[model samples]
Target chain A: MQLFLLILLGIGVLILQSAFPFYLKVAGVKPDLLTAILTLYAFIEGPLPGARLGFIYGLMEDILLGRFLGLNTFCRTLNSYLVGYAGQWLNPENPWAPTLLAFISVWLHYLFLLLPGRLAGFRYPLLPGIVNIIFPTALYTSSLTLILFILLRGGVSWKRGRRKAGE
Target chain B: MFPRRRYSLFLWMLLGGLALFLMGATGWRRDSLGFLEIAFREGLAPVQKVVATVGSRAYGWIEGLKSWRGLQEENRALKRELERLQALNIQLEEHRLENQRLKELLHFAETQGSDFRFVAARVIGRNPTNWYSTLTLDKGERQGIKRGQVVITSKGLVGRVVKVSPNTAEVLLITDRECAVGGLILENRTPGVVEGSPEFKGYLQMIHIPKEAPAEENQRVITSGLGGVFPKGIPIGVIVRIVTEPDGLMKKAIIAPFVDFDRLEEVLVII
Candidate 1:
């Protein structure tokens, strides 16, 4: 049941990412919601399930774009796995955890994504791409991560409180 | 514990290898979609279209409310522009008629006749990533849309179709780094290759102009029709800035495209 719910959440985020980000873009950059979600999930679930979810969601995005087929899959899976592995030692209850993880995950995600393409002879303006696209996107995603963490934490505590009342 | 650790290592290596292989196979060039990609894109396109429609409508409502005060001023400005255009239209009509008569007398063939068939499509979605500028159209192979076809709006050139499935097509916008077009300055007939600037968002750079070319700011640029893919004489944009190359042999001009890519809702594909 939890797996099903996660799948549903992934789909919802994908829909929001693709369909509505145009209106919400800041400086021609949109927040990377998948990175934030995967970071949060990896912190809670550990490396294996996080990697699996990343692979699934990343593949969906690549297939939808119909170009650079497995680029996102590799980036997201690796980032989620590393985040989840490191997450084993960190405390999730810390308010800054999600924000920090999301910021690093977005930077790592773009690095993994652009490096392979650049090696393949694609001429990308590395400095401008990092400064303009990557930095703003990471900052935006991290800010969003903070809000999402607060909301999720509230819901979890609310559920626990309800369970205690029933008991 | 030892066996579990080994299994996890093997799983990571396998997934990573598969991903790298897939990227190499599909990323280097414009490969045709595999069966799996086509199936997934076709499956998800309808849902994307519905969501995009609802989202755009809501956005339009909010923009309308926000701009209610400015509409009257905008309307008055448009009316003045319309009057000026109407006067210019009459003069252009007379010139066109005279040009047609001269062509008939000279036995000049109509080179542009029957060279184009446009397939109109709605913009349903955009590229989800910032790395590329692309749009998803509601029409595809069934509507005779093909790869490498030119996509344009009434305002100006948008881009070209890069990928197509049974029910959808993808347009690589002219703002994307990978896109380029053959362009000419209308005033001086100076030809150059226009490419999307990687360093700038929402702008294009026209390169390969000889240092001596008479291109200038505010001059209109149009398709040279040198490339067989795009037909000639389509308005591209106006030159906004010019810079001399380091070698001093060439110049590049910055262009602001006439199409509002952010607000594009519909496009016509030249099949």
Candidate 2:
């Protein structure tokens, strides 16, 4: 039940990301919300939870966007497990760590998405698309991640409090 | 500069990076569509309605202000119109003949035997991306709409349905960067393909017009009928300007589209 709730919650965040008009053109720049959500979950829960969350969230996005199957699935799952492991050393309470980590996560996601498109006989406007996806989303995702991480901490602590009371 | 413990996490991110690399490396990309997606899209209906209600109220208020000033002006105009009607009444028979002559070209669409289910829809959302000049229609599968359906206006052809869901569908507007139309140069008789420019340019470029074609500025451009997407002979736009390559091999012209897409509200979905 918790796992399903986490994945659904992540997808809800992604919808907010897609529905956001961060750019003047509106649809051009979409902040990586699922990436941030996955990152936050991975840091708090560890590797196994992170990977599972990532896989489920990616599948939901695939259904939502009507995208190519297994494409987002692979990228998102891998990032979650890795970020979860890396999250061990960080002070999850520190606002800036989550902020910086989100940039790295989104950047890595962008790079992965770019690689296959270039290799498979697709002509990618390499430098421009990289610049478009990476730099623009970095700052926006950072601020958003910071806020989301704090909210998540509050939720987690509240759950822990309830469990302790039951015991 | 890379943190050592985090270095391992980098490898996982690398796999994700690697997978995206694979997607980009190939020409194939997945585009998803199913009933659940359609339902999810339809789920946006409430949000759109909220925005629309606020917008309609704002528009109504502004229009009310303008109408007050306009009504006085219209009263004066009506006096002159009364005298003009006296003259028009005598020439009514002649005017009716002229109307039939002008409408002869329009008769073809009505006569064509095609199964059509018309759905009236509103423009609910627009692509928040710069590359997209597309709009999302408020009607979808619930209205029996589907991909490849034609969207037109009382004016003329608008575009075709490219993506669909249960209650909503995304329309590839004629003005979008990815949109292209097959058009005939009415004067020169040369057929060409028209696509949008990336300079954040609003106008269209009709490419590969033959040099032998009698091309000139300000000529009318219409659908060539070669592309199966749109019906032939619909008015596209007028040539605002033209240019040629350095070698003068093929010509390209700038076309100003007839419909002002930014202000679009109502459209007819032909299913």
Question: In terms of lDDT, which candidate is strongest?
Answer: 1
Which residue pairs of candidate 1 clash? none
Candidate 2 TM-score, true structure as reference: 0.54
**TM-score, per-candidate, Cα-based:** 0.71, 0.54
What is the per-residue lDDT of model 1 for residues B1-271, given as tens digits with 9 covering 90 to 100? 5699899999999999999998888885865899998999999999999999999999999999899879978999999999999999999997897565445423312332366667778788887777888888999999999999999866778999999999999999988888889998999999989888766677999998998888899999999989787889888999999988879999999999988888777677877
What shift in Å separates residue B92 of candidate 1 from its native position after superposition? 36
In order, candidate lDDTs are 0.85, 0.72
> After superposition, which runs of candidate 1 have C-alpha atoms over 4 Å from their true positions?
A120-123, B1-115, B246-249
How would you encode candidate 1's per-residue C-alpha lDDT over A1-167 as one tens digit per residue? 87778778877877776677678698879888889889999888999999998998888888777767888888889989998998888887985887899999999988776777676444567887898789999999999988998999999999999999999
Please give the lDDT score at residue A93 for candidate 2.
78
Alpha-carbon error at A142 in model 1, in Å? 1.1
Going through the candidates in order, their DockQ values are 0.34, 0.04
lDDT of 1 at B42: 100
Highest TM-score model number: 1
